[model samples]
Structures are given as C-alpha cells and as structure tokens.
Target: MGLGAGRPAATRGVLARVSTAVVVAGVLGLAGACAGGGGGGEGGQGRLAVGLLLPGGGASRFGQFDRPLIEQRVEELCPRCPAVAVAATPDPAVQRQQLESMITRGVDVLIIAAIDPKLLRPSVEAAHRAGIPVVAYDRLAQGPVAGYVTFDGAEVGRLQAEALLQAMAARGKGEQIVMMNGATSDPNAGWFKEGSLAVLKGTAVKIGKSYDTVGWRPENAFVNMRGAVAALGGGSIDGVLAANDSLAGAVISALNATEVRPLPPVTGQDADLAAVQRIVRGEQYMTVYKPFKPAADAAVDMAVALGQGRPVGSIATRTVDSATTEDIPSVLLPSVAVTVGNIKDTVVKDGMYTIDQVCPPRLRSACDKAGLTG
Candidate 1:
C-alpha cells in the first residue's frame, strides 16, 4: 500500500512501461490460444466476460502493478475476453455500487479485493444468484465468492514481528513494544495481527498497548502513535509493530516530534521507498516485500481464463470457498521480508524501483551503507 503513493507522475510512467511489456506477452499467448481453438473469433470460440474490483486507488502499486498486469494476463489467457474493473479507495458504499453494476452488466466471472469484506456480502450473494462466479482477491473477500487469491497474509505479520524482536534483542533492553495493526474491517489485517501475536507469545518484550489502525492512513497511524507516546511516556516504547510502511512513517514522525534521537525499531510492509530509506537510516527495522508482478499476473491469468470459458483448473493451484460459495480456482503467491541489507536483491533486482528513486542525492549515503548502491 505504501510504494509511491504520492507521486502519480512517476508511478504512471512506470505503469506505462510495464503495461506495454504485458500487452506483448498477452498478444503472443492469446493468438496461440485462439489458433489452437480453430480459426474463429475470440468470443465465437470461447469468449468470456470478467469483472474486477479492487479496494483502493491511492496506492501506486494498484494502478501501476495490479490493473495492467491483470488486464494483460486476461488477454493472454482469453483472446476474446472482455473485462471491466470497478474499484475505489476505502469507500465501501462505492464498492457496493460497483458490485451491483458488475452484476447488472452480466459478467461471467467476478474478481474482487473487497473494500469491506462484510458489507460486500450481499452483492457477492447476488452474483451467485445470477449464476456468476466470484474470486476473492487479496483479502479473502466474504460472501458466496468462489475462490481466494493472495499471498500468505499471516506470514507477512510474522516477518514483521520476527524482525522487530530481532531489533529489540540487539538493543539488549527488555522494553515494551507497541503494536499498530491495520483496519479491523480488513480480513488480512486480522490475519496479520494473529501472525504477529503468535510470534511474540513468549518473548521477553512486554506489550505496552496496541491499536487497530483505521484506513491504514499515515495520519491515523500518527495520531495513534501520539496517544501511545503520551500514555506510556515518550521513551518507554522499545519498538513499534506498525502494520505497514505508511504506519511506520507516522510512527517515526511522531517519535521524532518528541525529540527522540535514533528512533526505536519499527516494523512495516509494502516495501515503500520511504520505508526503504528509513531502513537505510536505521529508523525502521523491516518491511514485507511482496513481488507484485507474480501476484498481479496470477490474478490476470485467472480472470482471463474465466473470461474465455477455459478451465482455470488448469492454472490455479487450489480452490477456496467464501461464505457464499466454494471451489473457486485461485493462485496464492509468495512474499519476502525487506530490510536495509537486502533492498538490492528484492525491489531493485525486480525492477520495482530504480536506483535513482531509492538512491537520491539525500539517500545516497544511506543507500551505500545499506549496500543498495555501489
């Protein structure tokens, strides 16, 4: 959620380049697929209509990584597929409206990253009533959805917890750590919370207090951090378990506002550039680095396959049942943990970010220290 959220221009440029490559991949695969289906039109042979909905638009990763990548994959898997994407940022009402629109449009399949997993149930149920399939994207959207596609969210939390504990031990101080989790409305947030708690069960570190961050907003995290600081005394916190990089930023900012030198270790996710820089400066401990390419590509492939009336069973690794349905074809991807020491191996080598962006003049020294720039 954190990678390049503010700069739309740079994010759009990155998407433009990557989308072009995705298109090329799509055309080659799609043409071959249709040829094998006989010299008929895409739909005349096996055309499929698919619908997609995502939770947010503010994150650069969504438009830059998920949208075009999924579109291209659909093209590759289903030459004659028609796909529509309707999504918004943190607006459950808008998402509900979009779901209804998708249903009214009579799409054959639905893929959704639910804005509110619970509130979106009625629409998912309606899709089932109409005989359409649903694939829960990312957060295991609730209702009669067919399948679920996402990385191991619990593992993401575990990584952050492990890294924070490691950082705490390095200080050799038995101080308390504060947990700032994501929104309660999100299933992944709960999964992440459970994972982190599992890791910290027997540690010497005592929990001072925890808060469920709403909207995953930097401001919300900031306010929460301020509260924690006031309640526990500014310097009492040994570490912060910020659910993601955005929260980590807020935590660091709040801590710095108190005139604290060398901020306590904080855990984060999404591997946002700012967080990466923080890691370089030794302000944040770690973040979860999810390769958006694979996650994006897998969703695209599944959506496209659904659109083509082809068997997604050929591609998907497993089948999951949501509250409303079961046995929907899906793909679950893998993720990695990012720290200053391995930025080059994860985001850099994957071409998610260029050295220029990460190693700006101000961050040059930090990059060198982190082995990010030669």
Candidate 2:
C-alpha cells in the first residue's frame, strides 16, 4: 500500500540562523529559509515548516494524494504555521540529496516515504543527530522517525490473500495460487508478504510460484507472470496475488497476452481506478481500498504537531518501533477490501475519485452493473 521517499538534513532554528547566508543552496530549489523573517516564500513562519518528499518520479500517487492532501490538511490545521515543501525523485541518491536539503533548510519537521527504507537509515540518523523530527509516511523510515502513519501492510496482504481465496472458491479451483509480492527492498513488502503467507500457511491453498517484485516494478511483474504461466501453463494459473494495483495490471496484461481469455482471480491494493474498473469487469477479483484521506490527515496532524513542538500522541492511536526507537508515535489506519461490490462506499465516499471520472464511456455499463451510477 505504500513506498519510500527521501529528504535532506540541516540543523533546526539554531543552524538556520548561521545558515541564513546559505539558505539558497540549502533549499536546493525548494524555498528560502525563514530564520531571517519573510524568506520562506508563499508559505511562511508561525506556520509549520514541513518538508515532504515522495519516493517516485512525477505522475505518482504520492504527488497526487500524499503531497497535496498533506499540504491541504496542514493548512487547515495551522493556516499560519503550515509551510510544506515538496521534492520527488525516483533515484534513491537523489532522494537522499532531497532529504539533506530539507534538513539544511531548517524545516521544523520532515515527513518521508523512503525510496529505500534501509538505505535511508543514515539519513534518518542525520535528521536525529540534528534534533530534527521525522514522521515516517506510509512506510517505515528505519531511523529515529518520530511518528508513523500507515495501513497495516500485513492486513493488505491478508486482504489480498483472503480475496484470492474467495475468488478461487468462486472458480471452484483447488486452493493454489501464484504470489506476486513487491520489492524486497521495501520494509512494507516484507510485512505484506508475511501477512499473506500467514493466511496461506495452513489453509487448503498452496502457492504454486512466488516472486518478490523488483522495485515493485510492473515490468518485473510482467516478466514474473510470464514465467509463472510458462511453468504452470496458462490455464493452470488459478489465481494471482498481486501486491498492488500496478502489479495487478501487469499480471492481467501478461495473462491477456498469453490469451487466457477469462483470467483467474487477481488480488491488488491501492484501489486504483484501473483496478476498480478491472474488478467491475471481472478481470481482477479485488483491491484493498485504503481511505487515503484519513492517512493524509493523520500525517498533516503529525507534521503540524512536530512543527509546533506539540505532543503528537493526541493524534496518534498506536506506537511502533524502527531500528532506533522502541516506540514511535503512530497511526495504524485500517484498510477495506474493495471488490466489484463497494467502490462507492470506500474511495468514492472518501472523495478519492469521482463516480463520473471512474465511470468513463468504456466502463459505463460495467459501472452501472456495479451500482456506480453517475
């Protein structure tokens, strides 16, 4: 359900004072420092100086949902004290540079989704060494991240596993499926796999083949799916447990290329529009709808709380630890399983997407059949 991003490092208020002359170089195209007053650009002081970094390149859900929703919520909470700076780069090195830049610019708090959680450990340590607060966004940051907000990734896997099981039941296939897990680099991937395996362990189900997706890359999924088909025979693949919507899309594309007309049940997450549409058409069996608003809102609140030197415990409902801390403040958001039956109740209700946008001409009939009326 999530990925990593990066951020740079700089001192807090004290370092900002001496680094005033270097704010330009410090922001790294982000924005100027606010230590000298009126230098923070469109977003300023008394406001929360927050740094937001997303894991992928342009055209990702991080920018679409994580960045704006986070910025919006921050503004709503502290109109005067909310200043969010966003930087997204696909390269982990570039992300590391971004994280350092944010810290150098003196943001009160840093919120990140690591491009590589373990690799970013040094950066997280740098943030802590500088006394900067970090909130692990969506995935664990592995350092001394102060707060965390994310869905139970294990739950994400469990949902997909359960959905795959049900889909298998519908097809009257014996309990066996191929697993399409995410990249091994991401901590969340491991959690999701663990959860899914937990469900499949003693069940009647048997895993035919499984691949740990590289970078959670769709291409990798395609390659893996192709291999699965080659090994098991196209018709033998009873179900696919794709980790996310993107991977699910790849699996479906491969199955289509192989000319398996009526594809097996495939499970996905993120409740992406395409996945939802696939479900409506019966190509994909299910997706996990994580109401992103609440997660975004929680991040916003955590960022603001860190910015204002306020206690984040009020907004946090749970606690989790990474390598550095025993218990970091956290918000473990719930995830809902979205099949053809309830896109309206989850994402549409959460305003993640509009019914009209989702019910395009190609999908209009399917949408109607699924009860997603305009």
Candidate 3:
C-alpha cells in the first residue's frame, strides 16, 4: 500500500512526523486506563487471560526482548492478570493452529506476531467470532485486528538505502547494488522494498538483482546471494541491501564463499548482535535499530485494555489499514540507523545491548577502533 494516499488524516500526520516525544505522549494516555484498575474484564472476575504468539523463539529478538518486555509490562499494569500463555514458530500453519487453539480455550485477549499474515487471517477471524480481541504485534495480520504495534517499515528501508548510497559512494566505481528483501508473504518486506526503491530510483543506483528471500531464511538468502554473484560477476556488485540482519549475515557469507574481495557495503535491520559486530569489523555498513521496548509496551497496553473490554483509542498513537481491515488502532514507533559510528549512542545507550555484549574479547581491537570501549 502507498504510504499516505488513503490513510486517515490523523494517521497521515503521524506518518509525516513520528518522533519519540509523540510516541511517549500518545502511549502515556494508556496509563489512564490502567489507573482505572485496568478497566473491567471477563476472565474469571477481572483476571485477564492473555495469549502471546510469535514468529520465532530462541535467539530471535522476540525471545530475547519482545516477549519478556511485554510480559513484564503486563504484570506491572495488571498484577492480577493470568500468566500469559505464549507460543512461537516460523511456520504459518503451526501459527494458525496455535491461534485457533487459543481461541478454543477462550483467552480473553491474544497478542500475535503472525509468521504469515495471509494464512493467519481465518484464525484471526475465528478469534473475532469468539469475541476475543487479537492485538497484532510487529506484523500486521489480516482480519479484525483490534490493535497493532510496530516500527515504520518504510523509514527503515529509507535509512538502509540512504546509508548504502553513502557507502557505495566511497567506491567511486559503480552504483549497482543487489537487493535481498524479505519474504513476499511479509507485508513489511514490501513496505521496506518500496521505501528503499523510492530513494534508490531517484538516484543513479542501478539494481543488479533483487530476490525475496523465502521465509526470511538465511539459507534462502545464501542461495540468492550466490546466484547474484554468479550472474552479475562479483566485481560488478557494488553493494547489498539485505532486509534484516539474518539475511545480511547470509549475504556476507555467500560473498566470502564466492571470494568477492574487498566486500561491498551491506545494509541490514534488527540490529542483531552479530550484525553489530560485523559493522565494527567494517564488514557491514549499517543496521536499522527499532526500539523493541516501546513496541512491546504498547502491545501489552493494548492487550490489557482490550481484554478489559475497553477501546484502544487511549493507547494507540495512530490508526492503520490492512488489506482485511481499515483504521485499525496502531502504535508506529520510530527507528534509528545504527552503524560503527554510533553503536554506543543508539543500541548500547538504550540498553538493548551492553557495551560488554557488543564488544567481546575477540572483537576488542575492532571495538576499540569503533569507540565502543570504555
């Protein structure tokens, strides 16, 4: 979908200027709902039953950060809230079954980050039919989603593309970059791709090859990157715009395997620890750092309010439209561009990672050169 063409007027303003102050001010409004004893709920006389579903677990950002953050926020907001039942998988069929199971068990509210939004629509519809509100987390699942929370995908792409352009400029040889995007099933991937194209197309950059990595899998990315190398003749590939850190890692590995000397600049998202280390080692150009705390907090806030049979207007900073729904209440947080230059100021300062974590013993010299050390 185009960014601003059909969005609501209030949403357009948010799209125009999504800032930290605005996010804080908008989210603080949710506190009023919590102050009123978390409103009223139907789960065993005010104990809200929450269901949490993610696309991945174990080492993924959701496992390490989003889940814990959301769980903690739920506890702080509603001490009497039932322990949130959580499930995660990268398979759409499994995720759909999980949501259906939650609906059958009669959870008061569900927070889901769908592995494949389209495939999960029937389940989201089932939840709606069962009078259970589904709060779409990170990824905007189709159907009657009551609320949504995520970073601006377009802004993320813009940042990566702009950074790649700057890095490619240093080469002074060519302006051709391969685009390694996320799965087509992911709507955010399209947003990121469109956003990046908006920037790159306006410039002299020529896209040598572009592939949508299936399932956002590293193996898929490896194959695609290797093919791009073979097709474009490694030396002609000026840069790479891998959608996220996982794919970026694969792209780097493939390039190395192909013996592409003096690696071209690469861009990534999610600010994965390995990606950050790569940046320090001067192997990657930049990664988009989407602050997960605000997103998790907003999702939890929305879930609690929804479970209590309250409207999310108080919590949502803006409204968004999905293919199956329109004007869905949403909290779209801003993101930062992280590179070797501001690792400390962006990710480290936010406590997303400690200096010790990003600067390991083996990376001591690179860390020192990047000014990440004390």
Q: Considering every candidate listed, which one attains the maximal TM-score?
A: 3
Per-residue lDDT of model 1, residues 113-196, tens digit only: 876777777788898899877767787766665656787777898998998888888887657989998887777787788889
Tens-place lDDT digits, model 3, residues 149-262:
889888999999989998888778556899999987778888899889989886888999999888899999999999999999999999999999999999999999999988
lDDT of 2 by residue, 50-117 (tens): 67777853467676677777766655554454355567766556676678877777766787888777
Model 2 lDDT, full chain set: 0.75
lDDT against true structure, model 3: 0.81
Best by lDDT: 3
Q: Given candidate 3, what's the lDDT at residue 268?
A: 98
Query: Which portions of model 3 miss their true places by more than 4 Å?
Result: 1-45, 80-83
Go through the candidates in order and give the clash count of each: 4, 25, 0
Q: For model 1, give the RMSD to the true fold.
A: 8.8
> Candidate 1 has which clashing residue pairs, if any?
48-307, 143-324, 144-324, 144-325
Clashes of 1: 4
RMSD after CA superposition, every candidate: 8.8, 7.4, 8.9
- TM-score order of candidates, top first: 3, 2, 1
Task: Report lDDT (CA) for all predictions.
Answer: 0.71, 0.75, 0.81
Q: Judging by lDDT, tell me the better candidate of 2 and 3.
A: 3
Please provide TM-scores, in order, for all candidate models, with all chains considered together.
Answer: 0.83, 0.86, 0.89
On a 0 to 1 TM-score scale, where does candidate 1 land against the true structure? 0.83
